[model samples]
Target: MTIKLLAIGKTDHTDLQSLIDDYQKRLGFYVKFEFEIIPDLKKTKNLSEDQQKQKEGELILGKLNSTDVMIVLDENGKQLDSVNFSQYLQKHMNSGIKQLVFVIGGPYGFSPEVYQKANGKLSLSKMTFSHQMIRLFMIEQLYRGFTILKNEPYHHR
Candidate 1:
């Protein structure tokens, strides 16, 4: 299955962007991985939190194909270790799905509609992280997962 990461807004920090690019390039070697950023909503100071989530939900939903499986990277989601995450990916690939899309929501989190659309949710950690920082962490974890699958030297026991 093709893997795609959809996140709200750009990574403005050059350091984070560089690391994202590097891991993305390495990830491509193991699978068809795509990293996409959805533009952040503007003038959020005027909009209520719910309103912002609704708008962001629409944009997030717009990026999805009907056949795609959307898994949100959420704090309350089921947490997996590196090894299990790799097997989880293998299970999806074996199922012959066309695309697997993982989404990182805005700071306020998902709207009801977006939650309805998701096939599942995954948590990297129970601890909270900045939405921007999560982007980098997600990418790196993906890379490490692939390496673990291949018995590569990147991640030590």
Candidate 2:
């Protein structure tokens, strides 16, 4: 299955963007992976938190295809270890899915409509992380999961 990571805004930090690119390149060896950044919303000063979320939700939803499996990355979502995450990937691949999309929401988190569209939710960690940082972390974890699945030395047990 092809894996797509949809995140709100760009990673402005040079260091983080470099790492994200590295992982994306590495993941290419294992599977088709796409890292897409939805441009940040402007004029947020006049919009309420819910309003921002609603707008972001629309953009997120527009990126998805009807047949795609959408999973939102939320702090309150189910937490899984590296091994289990690999198994999760394996399960999806075995199911003959064409595309699996994982989304990282904007600052206020996903709107109710976005949640309704999601097939599931996953939490990378209990502690809060900047959206930029989470982009790197998520990609690295995906690379690690693929390595673990292949018994590569890149990931040590």
Candidate 3:
């Protein structure tokens, strides 16, 4: 399956962008991967948290196709170890899906509509992480998962 990571806003830090780029390149060797950045909402200061989430949810949902399997990254979601995450990826690939979409929502998190649309939710850690940094971390974990699947030396037990 083609894997796509959709995140709101562009990463402003050069260091984090470099790391994300590296992992994206490495992931290409294993699977079809795409990173799409949805531009941040404008004048969000005027809107309530719920309103902002609603707007962002519309944008997030707009990117998806009916057949795409949507997965949202949320703080309260299920956390998996590296091995199990690899197995998770394998499970999706074996399911014959055309695209598997993983989304990192805005500052206030996903709206109820977005959450409802997702096939599943995953959490990287219990501790909070910045939206920009999470992109790098997520890509690295994806790279690691693929390496584990390929019996490559990138991940060590």
Candidate 4:
């Protein structure tokens, strides 16, 4: 299955960008991977939390294709270890999905529509992490999962 990461706004850290790029390139060898950025809303001070979420939800849902299997990277979502995460990837591939989309929502998190569209949710960690940092972490985990699947030296138990 082709894997896609849909996150709100661009990452400002050049260092993080390079690291994410490195893992993305490495992951290409195992499976198709793509990262798409949804531009941040211009003004939010006047908007209610619900309104902000609704607007961003529209943009997030717009990126999806009907056949896509969406998974959200949510704080309260199911958390899995490296081996388990790799197994999860294998299971999705076995299911014959066209695309596996994982969304990292905006600052306030996902709206009802976005939540409804999601097939499942995954938590990388119990501790909170900055959205910018999550990009690097997600890509690195993806790379690690692939290496584990392939029995490569890139990752060890």
Best by lDDT: 3
Superior candidate under lDDT, 1 versus 2: 2
TM-score of 1: 0.97
> What are the lDDT scores of the predictions, listed in order?
0.93, 0.95, 0.96, 0.93
Better of 1 and 2 by TM-score: 2
Which digits, one per residue and each the tens of the lDDT, describe model 4 over residues 16-37? 8998888889999999999999
Q: How do the candidates rank by lDDT, highest first?
A: 3, 2, 4, 1
Q: List model 2 lDDT by residue over 1-157, tens digit each.
A: 8999999999899988999999999999999999999999999999999999999999999999999999999999999999999999999999999999999999999999999999999999999999999998999999999999999988785
The per-prediction tally of clashing pairs is 0, 0, 0, 0
Find the 10 residues in a row with the least total lDDT in model 3: 148-157
List candidate 3 segments past 4 Å from native: none
Error of 3 at 50 (Å): 0.3
lDDT of candidate 1 over 13-77, digit per residue (tens): 99888988998999999999999999999999999999999999999999999999999998889
Query: Which residue ranges in model 2 land beyond 4 Å of their true spot?
Result: none
| C-alpha RMSD for every candidate | 1.0, 0.8, 0.8, 1.0
